[model samples]
Structures are given as structure tokens and as C-alpha cells.
Target chain A: MGPDETAGHYLVANVPRARRGQTVAEVLSQLIAHAHDCMDVVCVLDDDERLVGVLTLAALFALERDRRLGDAVQPGFPKVHATTDQERVASLALHHAISAIPVVDAKGKLLGVVPSAALMHILRREHVEDLHRFAGIARETTLAREAIEAPPLRRLRHRLPWLLLGLAGSMLATLIMSRFEGALAIDPAIAFFVPGLVYLADAIGTQTEAVAVRGLSLSHARMRTIIGGEARTGVLIGLVMGGLTFPAVWLVFGSVHLAVAVAVALVVAGGIATTVGLVLPWLLGRFGSDPAYGSGPMSTIIQDLLTLLTYFVVVSLIVG
Target chain B: MGPDETAGHYLVANVPRARRGQTVAEVLSQLIAHAHDCMDVVCVLDDDERLVGVLTLAALFALERDRRLGDAVQPGFPKVHATTDQERVASLALHHAISAIPVVDAKGKLLGVVPSAALMHILRREHVEDLHRFAGIARETTLAREAIEAPPLRRLRHRLPWLLLGLAGSMLATLIMSRFEGALAIDPAIAFFVPGLVYLADAIGTQTEAVAVRGLSLSHARMRTIIGGEARTGVLIGLVMGGLTFPAVWLVFGSVHLAVAVAVALVVAGGIATTVGLVLPWLLGRFGSDPAYGSGPMSTIIQDLLTLLTYFVVVSLIVG
Candidate 1:
């Protein structure tokens, strides 16, 4: 496991914890005497120090000072194993609407708590990391301030790997277009739509990728439902765009067949784009890589190559 | 000012506070008795509830029980106005490494505290918002799970505006290509590179857009240094990609001059892509819009058109 996977790394070991039988007045004094930074909740432990419940400071304070801590404890509050990923820890805090998360051991003993301060840092860092990854930045720079202040040569070094990968993909795209040379020879009008077709398809795919990257992590919906919904959305987008394009292309080129070809190709490409967008991220996530790794330039060129092929084949079938 | 501009929106009004002369034991009792949800820090306010200093719960606990709260108070912690943007508030919290940010009015009277919970939510929500806008999803789906679960028609409604805008841009791209019909007719091989050239340029530009969007908001760097650095990065990327393409095109097509045309176009397109990417985002931010609004499909297609023009013009000059 990575260092972040160890809950101890983020845990604050000095926060207050209590046994259920302790009186509220006693535990309150102990807490006031022992509480660490960002101590908003007190963990309740069993005889073996296993986590049993949680009591918010607010709730504990509202009770009779003589009341037992056991009565104030809320059962089934969120807790994570010490080995949990930091992202999962942050997510749990968000889901439970809590400021801090308790970390336990394999045997369910209370380890420590991931404090609210660390949780805030995790969320902001993840935000910056996602943006950087989506923009094809390889090295992790987890603040907009850092990215801006980074040395130019360092910036180049960080950004060049993805562009180089894109360069290779562009070569493949060039090869694919070269293979369709005969189709272009039949009518150079086919080439006129190449950039447009690729651009629109890519635009559609990028939207899906954005949704999938973060959504896949937080969503509990079945993979089938998410993919199907995205695919349908893609087709709907394509239909509107294609519907608008059909007439515009016909009026401009004075060729009904060419217009039909462009419009049909767009609908097909849209469906393909969204499907590719959803699947690429899903696949990357399945392999434990970040879903966002599949969203930027590399996947874009892949989508472009496929869209180009679809456009040409549709044109050949319709306009020829 | 927007709702998010107000510190009150995220503030938790009820938390423990101390008068300057109170002993630690006196304040600790009051804090335990009145502590609300997520009360990790105590604000030391005067008789008028004007700002004084802050005392973390842990620090209070570690102090001598009879020690004055005023002596233990830490001064100069970050505070924000009621009208501050939530983004800036979160940034301040992160920069200062504090979980809770004190919100005060113009008179330096504490209005409330933006607790750690609200800070975490703001960061996560903004993260989702930035990704959504970058992907051209117009509606604000504050959670990633909500985006994944949104109905297809709703998703279509949210996403189609940008694709349609892309459709119009794509049509402009077609017209641009058609204007170059004479050159394409002279050499159909020129058409082979249209999609590749446009895609690579868009990829390069998107990276710059991502950097500029975040960087512009956070950096104190001079505009000249930033633009100059990014422009240089673009040229370096272009040089490498262009140099790689020249030989490959020459080998495949066996035409030195055609290869030169494509290679030179790549270099020129590279330079233009990065420059546009940096400028568009910077320009958007200068006009008080979010910089990320300039980094998505709209700017991408704009890059595509310009790249297409550059390619055709370069080819025309070289091979015509």
C-alpha cells in the first residue's frame, strides 16, 4: 500500500476518546483536558479499545452533566480502517456530513482520527490534482499557485510528456487519413469536413470524459446505467447538431447527398464519442489508474481517429 | 455580489468565544457548555464582539487551567470580509493552513465563522464546477454523483449548447477548408493532415488553457513573464512535434517539399495554439469571468480553425 493508504499518516493521535460508562461530566472534563486540534467528536471505545460509537461535542454538552457517555453516543457513525485511502477518507467525511473521520485498525481498535484540517487539505489538493491531470500535466503540482509560480523549464518538463504522447497519436491520425486518400480523391469535399467532424466529435467525447472521471469515483449507480445514460445523451446531442447541420450543409454545398452524409456521420460519431469517453475512463479506473488519466489529449486523438474513419465511411456510403 | 460572495452563506454563527480577561478554566467551562457542531476553534471577541484573537481547543487544553485566555490567544490569523468569494475564502483557509476562517464585517466585528465542514464542501463543489464548465456542461451539478445520475434529456439539455456552438464553429471550419479548395486540389495529400494538424494544435492549446486558468487566479507573476513563458513552452513543443513530423511525412510520401509544408505548419500551429490558449483564459479572467470558461470546446474549436488556416496557408506558400 502507498503511504497515503496508511491511516496513521493523516491521523491525529491525541484527540479525546472515551469509554461508554464514563459520566458526561467526567468525560467532558477529560475531553477539555485532553482534546487535540480540531477535536469536534469524541470516539467511544469498547473494553478492547474497539470503536463502538461517536458523540458530537454538541450532543454531549446538551446532555445532563451526570449522564453516561454511552447514552450520548450515536452508533454507526462513519469510521475507516487505518489503511484506507485518503480520498476515501475525505469522501466518507463528506457523505456523513462530518468534519472529521475516525480511523481504526484491522481488529477494529481505535487508531486515531483524521482531523478536519487534514480533510480540508485533502479536498483542495485533490481538486488541483484533477485539474492538472485533465490538462495532461504529468508531474503533480497540487496548487494553482504552484503551477503559476513553477519555473518555465519545470513547466515544460511537466507538460511535455502528454504532448509527446499526443504527437505519436497525431502520427497515427495522419496514417489513418492517408489510408482514406482514395476517398478524398473521389471528392475533396470529404476533406473539407475532416477538421470539423473531428472537432465536434472530440468536443462531445471530452464532456463525457469529464463527467465520467469524477462521477465514476463517487457514483454508486451500476456501470450499465451510467454508460447507457451517457450514450443516450451523446446521441441526443448529435441529433440536434446533425439536424442543424443537414440543412446548412445542403444550402452551402447544393448537394443533398453530401449533406445527408455529414449529418448521418455526426450522429454516428456522437454516439461513438460518448461511448468511447465513458468506456476509456471506466477501463482506466478498473485497472486502478485514475479515470481522469483517460480523459485528455491521448484519448482525444484516439477519438479523433475513430471519428475520422466513421465520417469517411459514411460519406463513401451516402455521397458516393 | 453573488450569494457565494457573502461570508454569511457558509458561516456557522454559534461557537464558543472568549473575553480578553477570562482565565483558561473559565473559558474552557463556557466552551464545553456551549460548544456547537464543529467547534474546533474559539474566537476571542471583545465586549462589542469585535475581533481580538483565536485559541484552538487543543492549545486551550494544554495551557495552565488558571491562565488568562488573552495571553494564550494567537494573533494575525486569516480573516475575510462578508462579501468575499467562497473560492477566495477557501483559498485563504488553505493558504493559512487553518480549518476555520473567521468572517468579520467592515468594523472588525466577528459575524461568524466559516467552519471546516463548509470549507471542505466549498472546495469539492468548486472542483466539480470547474470540471463541468471545462467540459461545457452549463448547469451546475454540485456533486459528481449528481452528474452521473442526471437524466439523459437533462444531460442533453445541459451539454448541447456547447456542441451546437461547436457545430457552428465546425461549419466555419468547413468554409475555411472550402476556401482552400484550390490548394487541396493541387495536392490532395495536404488534406491528409487537416485532422491531425488541428487535433494536435487543439491539444497543445488546451494544456496552456488549463495552466492559465488556474495560474491567473493565484499567481502574483507579471503578465509579461507568464505569457512569455507559455509562448516559449508552446514553441518548444511545436519544434519537437514539427521536427518529428517532417521526417515521417518525408519518408512516407517521399516528397521533401510536401513534408516541409506539413512540418512548418505544425511548428506554426503549435506556436499559435499555446498563445491563443494562454491569452483566451487570461482575457476571460481580466473581464471578470472564470478563466476556465475559455479552456473548453469553444476555445478548442477556435484553435482548430486557426490551425486549419495556418496549415493551408503554410502548405499554399510551400507547395503551391
Candidate 2:
């Protein structure tokens, strides 16, 4: 069978299990008599063989030997369906502060527990995947070593799709620039800030993207609340950056109007960047894609184009 | 004591431990009589109290009850120094595929184990930290919720330092552009490629930084081998990107010289971007700082400056 990226794939079928009516001493004897792949948590099942609850080995160890396992079972312990994505399984473990997560079928039958080792492996794999995705790498390599040591052609294949898309976006940026030829002809000084403006906008947007990528999934706040906060943060960042740049540009270039244009553009671009950063990830998450896919080169080019447009608009009004 | 970011902080002193001479049955009875903060593995110690080996619970359960703990112990099980960085502790756990890592003193006495839960926490925390750092966030927020929900001013405090640094870099980029006024005046079309070229270079470089940030620590490959491979990857990426752009530019702008300049600039910048991406992280690791610190806004600005210089020189040579 092909590799499946689900909780089922990591399930350990031979995990320690016990019937609820059994005494803790009886369960301990059974555990000692048998070998189980995972012993971190013992799954407790009902008479019908449906999963009841889980008892962590630590809790099991501390319990009175004569007490029934039913009394020791942790009711409503976190569990996942077999089809749940591997990342969600790891996240569930982190959220619940548990080392093992039980995987069950639709009929509430206990399949197996995803062992701690698999949880660790899944978290690490997802971490590497997220980093690579954020960097615009098309494929997620399982190991950091493979990512770096892969042949150039293989690396290119993994890296080029997004870059080609970026190239297309850059073409649009050039088209936009060409339309502003008259402004550049009138005063070449306006062109000086293009790279700088784009860079600041990208940097600001990327920070928001970084926070929002996983943040969107973890946060329970309403969309409006989150977006409003981010928009304000963006505006605040833009204002500060613009304020810092204004006097410097004015002093260095000796042009107050040019400085004002740059300052105003920074403020607007900052707001736009943060908004785009938050919204894109949210939108992608809404569409059932990994929110990280919304970041990297896609959002970057969008931020660049918007920053360029904002700069030219501000420059036209102030300097022209 | 203040919260120290080291393996000692996460150390669980009450972990299951056994003397090398104890039988599996004897150790199991003692384990039942006492409570341990961690029980995934039993640390076996010598008469002098130095750790000799470790025995996983699974291995312990499968062994004959009469077998000595020393017979079951796995010698040279993965371990860490008490003062080891938390991230390194997690990495060691992952690298060794062990959930619990024994932390020992310089004298080889076992202090305790960094239990599975802490390992999970560390991996997740470090994931967030790396993403934030790569995005140029100055401070690491423990919770994704806090990173998003913090007050705008508070968020600014966490994020502004890097943007300020980036702004300074942007200023340098502006200065570089000013010096190339002569080249731009010769042909306004040259300026159209500036944003696109810089963006491509940044994209290429970021991919390398993403890989190298973690790869530098995990990889056993020599520095030269890694660098040489990345440089070639960069050049390959550049050629493909440049070749594709050349035809598009020449067809649209009807300027063979301008297309050639943009294409050539891209090839050179790609090589430079990958090299900087790998070297910056490697250098930071060599200096005892996180290799991640070399990424994000720091390496990005470096790549931008180099890309700008390369583009201008190419423009001056061809388009001018």
C-alpha cells in the first residue's frame, strides 16, 4: 500500500489495553505477562469492545492496585479518528499535553494508539515541511539532510515551480513600472525607493505571515477580531517605519516632497502588507489547504505589487 | 532560579532508575512500589553512580524476569549534558529516535532525563521560534495566540527591531540605486527589472536559508561539499529562471541588450543568493549563535544588496 498521511498510518495496534472491570493489579499482571509496542498509555475498553477511556502509565502506576480500572480511566481523554491528518494528530497531542493519542474508527471501536515515537516523528516532519513550504519549496523533504544534499536538478525541480510563478508576478511588476515611465522621466529620484519600499513591505508582511501561518489554526478568536487587530498592527508598524524614513530621505536627498511621498507610501504599504498576510493564510485555511501554502512567494509577489502601486500613487500626488 | 533555556531546566530527577546488578523482576517490583515522573526508560547506573546504559520499558517488558538489568541495558543510548540548549536536546532526541534523553553531568553521573513531554514542548516551541526569527521577529512568543493577540504596541516591540534593521538595509539599497542613476538615465527600462530581479534573488536565497538553518546542525557533510552543492543549485535555478525571462523580456520590450542584462544579472544573483544563504547560517553556527539568526531579515538584506549590485553592473555593461 502507498504511504498514507493519516493517524491510521502511525497507529500501533499492539498497545496495552485493559477491560474496565479488571482490577489495577490484574491489569498490571497482564501488562507484565505480555509485550506491547506502546506502554505509555493503556486504552480502556467497554464490554462491547468500544473504547471507553485512557489511563496513562504514570496514573496507572500511582493507582491503588485493588481499585478497578474503570475508576482509574481518564474519561473524555483526547482521541482522533483514523483519517485525521498527521499534523492534527501531533497538534492534538500538544494541545492535550499527552504523549500518546488513541485512534478510533467511525463506529467508536478502538483501533490503536498513535505511539509517542510516532508523535515525535510527526511533529518533526511537519516542522521541516512547514519551513520548506514557507521558503517556497514545492515539495517537502522528510529530512533536513535530504533537503540540502539533494542533487541540484532535484532541488531545482522542487524550487522552480514557485519561482516560475514569482517570475510571472515580477513581469506584472515590470508592466506596472513601464506604465510609470513618464514619472521616472520627470524625476529619476522616485525610482530610488522602489527596492527599499518593496523590501520593507515584504519584510513587514512576512512577519505577519509567520505569525498567521500556524496561528490561524491555533487561534480561536473570531475572524473579524483577528483581522482588526492585525490591520491596526500593520498601520502602527507602517506609521513608525514611515516616520523613521521621512526625515532621513528628506535630509539625504534634500527634498521634502519626496520624503513625504516615501513616508506616506510606507504607512499605506504597511497596512496593506499586514492585511494581505493575515487574510491570505486565513483564506487558504478556509479552503482546506495548509495555511502555509498561502505564504512565501505567492503573498510576497502580491505584497510587492501592492507596495509598488502604493508608492507610485503617493509619489504621483506628492512629487508630481 | 531564573528560567534557564537548558536541558537542566527540563530535567526530571524522579525518573525510573536501577542498579546494574538488579534483575528485571526486581526492578519491575521496585518500579511498581514507587512513582516516577518519567518511566519510558530505566537508567542503569554503576556502583559509582555513573550511568552505564538505558533500558526501554518495551525491552524491559520483553526480557526474562530473571535477567539482570545490565544484560538488558542498551549501552551508549543517546544522552545530553545538563547544560545543553533546549533546542539541541530536542534535536538529539529526534536524531536518536528516543523519546526521553538522559541528561548527565561532566563526570558522567546521570542528573535526570528530559522526559518525552518536555521534548515535545521543546520541538513545538522551537518551531515557532525559528519561524518568527526567519520572518525577522525580534522576540520569540511562546504561544501563537499571544503572537497574534498582543496589543499593537506590544507586537511592534517584538517585531520592530528587525524591521528597523531592515529599514537601514533598505536605505543602503536606496543608496546603491542612487549611484546607478547614470545607468537608469541611459534607459528607463533598466529600472523596470530592478524589483523583479531583486525579488527573484531574494526568493532563491530564502530557499537555501530555510534548508541551511536546520541542515547545518543535522548534516555531517563537509562545509565545502554543502556550499559547492548549493552554489551549483543556485546557478542551475538562475539559468532556468534567466533563460525563461530572456525570451519574455526580448519579445515584450524588443530590447535584446536589456533582456541579456536582466538574464545575466539573474544568473549571477542566483549564485550569490544561494551562497549567502548557506554561508550566513553556517557562520552563525560557527560563532555559537543559532544558525536561524543568520536567516530572516539579516541574510535577506545581504542577498538584496548583492543582487542590486549585480543587476546594476550588468545593466551598466549591457543596457548602458
Candidate 3:
């Protein structure tokens, strides 16, 4: 089996054995007999005496229910390869709601298996970590390396491009601030939520982008479906989030005018955050980029800029 | 599943067959016979019916290679449950390298079988979505309800206290900014890279947090072991990223000293970012928090405040 390490990696992939015109009865007998074992087993076939599908007890019973004893092997059983990634194999099992899945190769040969036990702990840890990372924090130190690789770190240290780009975007906020300076002059209270609103929108967009990016990464999860449902969800979430947040703003900042402005901004920002968040990940996925990283800066920049601009526009609508 | 649908809606999970005892020969016979339809079968103890092991083709062969046909059923076999999370069950199969794991009751009776192909797709989508969310985005809508329940949005929306706490932390930076307004007035040049440096550390920390948190969540990757490796990775990434940024800063500001300051900021920020980046996720993980969202505000606030404080301190080191 494909592995990055020798330790802590164990799997028991299924192999379907219906090739070479094996009858249903023969297949079922073997399946029923092998249903108890120390590890997952497979049926090896020979295109010229090669290997084929993995056999499991569950697979046997299902086919047995449908085909009785002697049905010819049906199609759609998975084949496996040695080079396949455990992570991917695990993902396939997860998406299908299966306790086990076959790992296949280019030539449709049987490989080893990625067992459920090997995958669950990893997936759970990944989910937990992803949640933490999305919130923009670290998780565990017990796993840290004494000396990390330098190649990746060196590639990540750009200040000018990001800053210049961010500055260009942040400067737009300066322009918006200037336009709204008069409002702030009348009451500096307007400035209070400017950053807050911007950060709020930034957070929302980040959330949307994170989920979309992850959804797209799974080979089985449909990207279009993810994109399709985002807007409606965003609207609903926005309505609720805005409903709760506006009064809090009013309570905390003590300005009905600014609170209303923030409310309007939240609704629009929430919608935009969802929209941009979904679209950007989709766009990144289309371009074959890591949508996760690709959407990060762009969404943040857009949200920060758009939220600020919207704040002023809303303020002008309410106060001007 | 135990669901958050409409706050109390529930969906029942597929019930799996419990294990029944069979001899190793019985297990192998099933694998050799009906390999195509093994997903439905379950194996347990023949005498006490203790569910000594799960029966799948792959595991059968593995056992065969290791032992004579007379060995007692031991560990390294597939096991699952009717109530096992569909996604988690799939992942477990892949991880343990088993084709199909047995599903048992609380008392360990066989239920039904879920093939890896079924459950794993759910796992993959959930995982990728979580990764995306780890970057601070919302999950998509069209996915199953189980995909996004209790997700970042739900938790993050409840983050008013944390947000306020982080705001208090951010206020420290604001305080520093206000106090250091005089220093910046003395030389806005120093102010130029303050945000840059802080943000750089932030970016670096973010990268580390992303990797570390992901590592922590899935026991597969190790954050502690990867820390030094990450530092090296950061250094390498910093070199490349910093290399790209230096000229850009010089082009905009037209100051060699500013370029140098920004460059220094990139280096120090990169180093420190990697350090804290690895530290925070582990700490959060140890505390049993989702390190993904956990690191966002807390780490950023800490980074920004300390970054600014370090900024002036560095300035004093150089200019004072």
C-alpha cells in the first residue's frame, strides 16, 4: 500500500472477485466463508492471473440478496492500486457512507486496503484542526517538528507584494474614510464600527470561502452543488446574524444611526461575503489552485474594501 | 444522525450487522468465494459470539499470510456499529486498511454492513469542508445537513464574548497605536512597516497555524515533530516571499532604509510567526478546543499587539 511512513498506518481494503466469469454462487460462498478474519481479504483474479476486487462480508450479503446464488458478477465494483493516497481512499469511503471501499489502480488491479480505523482518527483530527485553523489559530504542539523544513517557510515570507496589494486595497478604505470624514467630524461615533464592520465582513467571507474550498477538494463532493446552495444559506444566515448583531451594536456603541448603518452593512456584507466567498473558491478551484489559500487574501481584501465602501454608502443613505 | 437540523431534527443512521464468530477458514472461504458482494456480511465468535473479528477479503488474506489457518481471531479486523457516523465509519475503514468493517450493537451483535465506498464520500466532503472552514469560510449549502452542523459559523456567531475579548486585545494595539502616534509622527517611515511586520508575523503564524491545527486534528500528521520542519519551511517560504516583496516596497517607498526595515520585519516576523504559529495550535488543541477558529482572533490579536510592541522596540534598538 502507498504510505508516507511505516508506523501507524494499517488498512483492509475490499476487492471484488467477479472477474473471469466467476459465478454468483462461487463468489457468495467465498464471501460468506471469509466474513470472519483478522484483516480484510480480497479475491485475486487473472487478466492473465493478476489481481482484481476486494471481497468483504457486507458485499457478499448485498449481492446475495439481489442475485441469489449464481448471478454473473455485475459491474461497478471498485478496483484498487498501491499508489493511491490513504487520505483520498478514506474520503471516498466517507462520502459513500460505506464501512469499507476498494482501492483501485490505473489498470484496474487490486491493491491493499485503507481500513476505517486508520482513517477515522485522522479525519476527526483533521476536522478539529481545520476548525481551529479556519478560526485562525494553532491546535497542538505535541506534533510539532524539532526542525521544520526551510523550503516552504522561505517561499512564504513575502511582505511587499501582499502589503502593497493589501495597501492598495486598504488605501481604498482611506478614500472611503475621507468621503465619510464629515460624518465622523460631526460625530466620531461613525468610525467606531468602521473597523468592526469591516472585520465582521472579513470574518464572514473567510467562513464561506473556507467551506467552499474544502467542499471542492473532495473528488466526490460536487463543486456546483456547493456553489448553488451558498447564496440561499448566506441570506438566511445573514438575516439571523444581522438581526442579532445590530441590536448588539446599538447597545454597545450607543448609536441608533450607526447601528442601523451597521445593520444594513451586515445584511449586504453578509450576502456579499457569502457570494464572494463561494464564488472565489469556485474560481480558484476552476483554476486548479488551492482554493483554500487562493480565496483567503482576495476575499479579505474585497470584503474589507467593499464593507468600508458599503458602510459609507449606507451612512450617506441614512444620515446624509 | 444526531443532528442540528432545525435545532432538533434527526435522521436515523444505517444499522450494520454485528459480528458472529467463525473460524479463520470460514472467513477465508467467503473471500475466495463471493468477493463481489462481501459488504453485507458480518463475522463474530462461533462459541461465546464475542465478535472476535470482522470478516472481509482483505483481512482474511492478511491473516492467512501471517498465520496458519488455526490462529484465533485477534485484533486488526474491521468493526463498526449501526449508530456509527456514516462518515466516520468510512474513514475508519480506510485508515485501518480494511475493506469492510463489521457493525455491532452496544452489546456487540452484528447489525448490517456499510461498505467503504458508501461512508467515505461523506467523510471526504466533511473533511475538505472543515479544512476550508479552517481558513475561516462557511460550508456550502447543497451538501447534506450533517456536513455543516455545529460548524464554524454556529460557533463563531457565538463568539461575541471572544470577539470582545479579542477586541480588548486589539484595543491593546489601538492603545499602542495611540501612544505611539507620537513616535509615528516622528517618523511615519517606522509606521510604514509596523502593519507590514505585524501582518507578516500574522501571515506566517497563519500558515503555521493552518498546518499545525490540521496536523493536530488528524492524528496522522504531527505538529510537534513538524515544528522545526515548519520553521525551516517558513524560512524558505520567507526567503521567497520576502524576496518578492523587498523590491516592491523599495519601488513604492523609494527608500532603501524602508526597504531594509521591511526586510528585517519579514525575517523576524517569519521566524516568530513560525514559532508562535506552531505553539498556539498545540496549546489550543491540548485544551481540547478546535484549534482552527481558536487561533484566528486570539493569535492575531496577540500577534498584532506584540508585533507593534516589537515594532517600537526594534525601532528603539535601531534608532534610539
Candidate No. with top DockQ: 2
Cα lDDT for residue B155, model 3?
38
Q: Write the per-residue lDDT of candidate 2 for residues A224-303, one digit (tens) a residue.
A: 99888988999999999999999999999999989988998899888899999999888888887888873777889999
lDDT agreement with native, every candidate: 0.80, 0.86, 0.52
Fnat computed for model 1: 0.78
The sequence of per-residue lDDT tens digits that candidate 1 reaches over residues A226-249 is 889888888888898889989988
> What digit string (tens of lDDT, one per residue) describes model 3 on residues A1-320?
12542112444434344445555566555544443332333354656534534444444444543453223333455443555544455555555444545554556555445555555545554454444333333233112221133235332332224434554554455455655556655554555454345555655665565555555554354555555456555555556656765776677657788778877876787668777877876676578643444366667677766767787788888887
Q: Each candidate's DockQ score against the native complex?
A: 0.71, 0.81, 0.18
Candidate 3 versus truth, CA RMSD in Å, comes to 8.5
| DockQ versus reference, model 1 | 0.71
Model 1, runs deviating above 4 Å: A35-38, B35-38
Fraction of true contacts retained by every candidate, in order, equals 0.78, 0.75, 0.19
TM-scores across all candidates? 0.96, 0.97, 0.60
lDDT tens digits, residue span B161-212, model 1? 8887888888899999999888777778888888788888888887777666
lDDT value, residue B235 of candidate 1: 80
Instruction: State the lDDT of candidate 3 residue by residue for B192-267, as single tens digits.
Output: 3443355455555655665555455445445555566666665664565556666876686576655665566566
Q: Residue by residue across B121-153, what tens digits does model 2's lDDT show? A: 888887887889888886557577789988888
**Which has the better TM-score: candidate 1, or candidate 3?**
1
**lDDT measured at residue B284 in model 1 versus the true structure, 0 to 100:** 80
